[model samples]
Target: MIRHILLIKFLATADTAQIKHLQTLFEAMPQKVTGVLTVEWGVNNSPEYRNKGYTHSVLMTFADEAGRQNYLPHPEHLALKQVLRPLLDDIIVFDFQL
Candidate 1:
């Protein structure tokens, strides 16, 4: 299995509604793409305040490396990126085997 993580920093102009819309889009991925086992989203709520401006996170679990690779170029993912790009100041993607 693979654990895929995304740390997101949205632009100041991005509103709550837009953020929620993005979350909705992300939540739909498992149903739209094969081998996507699960998708989880969350907002930063740490008391330590060490998020470095990243306010949201998306965590995806894939069945295998092929699943992760497949997700990279999937049409649904491309569409999601189109919706996400304009709202972001920056993003960090990290993955690890599990």
Candidate 2:
């Protein structure tokens, strides 16, 4: 299995509704893409406050490396990026085999 994680920081102008919409889109990925095992979304909630302004995260599980690669250029992912790009102040992606 592969673990794919995204850390996101929203632009100051990004609104709650837009953020929620993006979350909705992300949560729908397992249903839309092949080889996607699961998708999870979350907000920063630590009292430690070490987040460096990153406010949200997406954790995804893929069946394998090929699945992860396939997800990168999938049309649904591209569409998600279209919605996500404008709202972002910064983004970080991390992936590893599990």
Candidate 3:
């Protein structure tokens, strides 16, 4: 299995509505993409306070690397990026085998 994790920091201009939309869109990915085993996301709520301003995270489980590769260029993924790119300050993606 593969775990695809994304951490995001929103730009100042990003509003509550946009963040909610992003959350909803990301949570729906397992249904839209064939190889997506699971999709989960949430606002940062850790008390550790070491996040350096990153405020949201999305974790996706895939059957394998090929599944993740398929998802990267999928049209649905591209559409989501179009909506999110403008509002993003910074983002980090980490992938690993499980």
Q: Clash totals for all models, in order?
A: 0, 0, 0
Which ten contiguous residues of candidate 2 have the minimum total lDDT? Answer: 64-73
TM per model? Answer: 0.97, 0.97, 0.95
Report the poorest 10 consecutive residues by lDDT, candidate 3: 34-43
Q: To one decimal, what is the Cα RMSD in angstroms of model 2 from the true structure?
A: 0.6
Candidate 1: RMSD over Cα atoms? Answer: 0.6
RMSD in Å for all candidates: 0.6, 0.6, 0.8
**Candidate 2 C-alpha lDDT tens digits along 33-85:** 99889999999999999999999999999999888888999999999999999
Better of 1 and 3 by lDDT: 1
Q: Model 3 off-target regions past 4 Å?
A: none
Candidate 1 lDDT over 3-98, as tens digits, reads 999999999999999999999999999999998999999999999999999999999999998898899999999999999999999999999999
Per-residue lDDT tens digits of candidate 3, residues 8-89? 9999999999999988888889899878899898889999999999999999999988888999999989999998999999
Position 84, candidate 3: lDDT: 91
Model 2 misplaced regions, further than 4 Å: none
Question: Could you tell me the lDDT of residue 78 within candidate 2?
Answer: 99
User: Which residue pairs overlap in candidate 2's backbone?
Assistant: none
Better of 1 and 3 by TM-score: 1
